[model samples]
Structure formats: structure tokens, C-alpha cells
Target: MKKTYKIKVDCAACANKMEEACKKTEGVKDCNINFMMLKMKIEFEDGVDKDEVMKEVLKNCKKVENDCEIYI
Candidate 1:
């Protein structure tokens, strides 16, 4: 499945970091961070625990850019 969420990335560089971070995260098949739209698109892997996976993704995102918000 696919999901999109609001994000708070500071700039393009941070967006790139976020993309890398999301791709590294387990349970994510694909990801795209749209800085202009302040949104994130996540394509989930089958059998993935949605909430838990997102929580980890959120945690990973915060590591790169503290203010980026991923609306659950």
C-alpha cells in the first residue's frame, strides 16, 4: 500500500537525507519526499506493521532533520 503524510523538511538537502533514511528503513518499498509540497510518500512492503514501521521511519527522519513531521 501507499501513504502520504505532511512533512516539515527544512531544505532540499534535508529532503535528500530524508529520502535516503526512508529507503533504508525496513517495511518501506519506496519513498519520495516533496519539499515543495511538504509531504512524504511511502510505499509499504507487504506484511509490514504500519504503525510500528512508521514510528521507526519517523524516528529515522528526526535523526536527519529534527523538525520534519510525519502525520501518523
Candidate 2:
């Protein structure tokens, strides 16, 4: 399944970095961060746990932008 999440990203670099962070997450299959919308679309691989994946998303996103929100 795919979900769109609201991300509090500052600029293009941060957005790109956030996308990379999400993609590197273990449970995630794909990720796209749109700077204009400040939203991140995530697709999970089959059998991946959504809650577990989101935890990874939140953790990695913090590395890109501290205190940023990622609404799933």
C-alpha cells in the first residue's frame, strides 16, 4: 500500500535528503518527497509492517530536518 505523508521540509536539498532517508529505510519499498507540497509519498513492500516502517520514517526524517512532522 501507498500513503502520502505531510513533511515539514525546508528546501530542495532537505527534501531530496528526506527522500533518500526514506528509501534507505528497511521496510519501505519506494519514497518520493515533493518539495512544493512538503509531502512524502511512501510505498511499502509486501509483508512489511506499516507501524514499523513509519517508525523508521520518523527516525530517519529527523536526521534530515530536526523536529519535522511526517504525517502518515
Candidate 3:
């Protein structure tokens, strides 16, 4: 399934990092972060729990951009 989320990121490069981090997360099939929009689009892997996956995505994103926020 696909989901869109509001995000807080400082810059384009950090948004790119968040996208990469989210894609690498286990339950995510793909992810895109638009810095200008401050939004994220996520394609989840089959049968993954959305809430769990999002939590992980947030954690992973925080690793690269500490102040980044993903509104669940």
C-alpha cells in the first residue's frame, strides 16, 4: 500500500537522506521525500503493518537527520 505523510526536514539534501533511509527500512518498498512540500510518499511492502513500519521509518530517518520529524 501507499501512504503520504507530513514531514519536517531542514533541506533538500536531508530530505534525500530521509528518502534513502526510509527505502532501506525493512517494510518499505520505496519512498520519496519532497523538501519543498515537506511531505513524504511511502510504498509499503506487502502485508506490512503500517504503524510499525512508519515508526521504524521515523527512527531510521532520525539517524541521518536528527531533527527530522515524520508525523504518523
Report RMSD for candidate 3: 0.5
- lDDT of each structure? 0.91, 0.88, 0.93
Q: Which model scores highest in TM-score?
A: 3
Q: List the residue pairs that clash in candidate 3.
A: none
Question: How far off is residue 17 in model 1, in Å?
Answer: 0.4
Which is the better candidate, 1 or 3, if ranked by TM-score? 3
Query: What's the candidate order when arranged by decreasing lDDT?
Result: 3, 1, 2
Question: What value does the lDDT take at residue 35 in candidate 1?
Answer: 89
Q: Distance from true position, residue 54, model 2, in Å? A: 0.7
**Candidate 1, residue 26: lDDT:** 96
Question: Tens digits of per-residue lDDT for model 3 on 1-72?
Answer: 999999999999989988999999999999988899999999999999999999999999999989988888
Candidate 1 lDDT by residue in tens digits, 1-72: 999998877899999999999999999999998889988999999999989999999999999989888887
Model 1 gets an lDDT of 0.91
Backbone Cα, N, C clashes tallied per candidate: 0, 0, 0
Residue 12 of model 1 has an lDDT of: 95
Clashes of 2: 0
* Model 2: lowest-lDDT 10 consecutive positions: 63-72
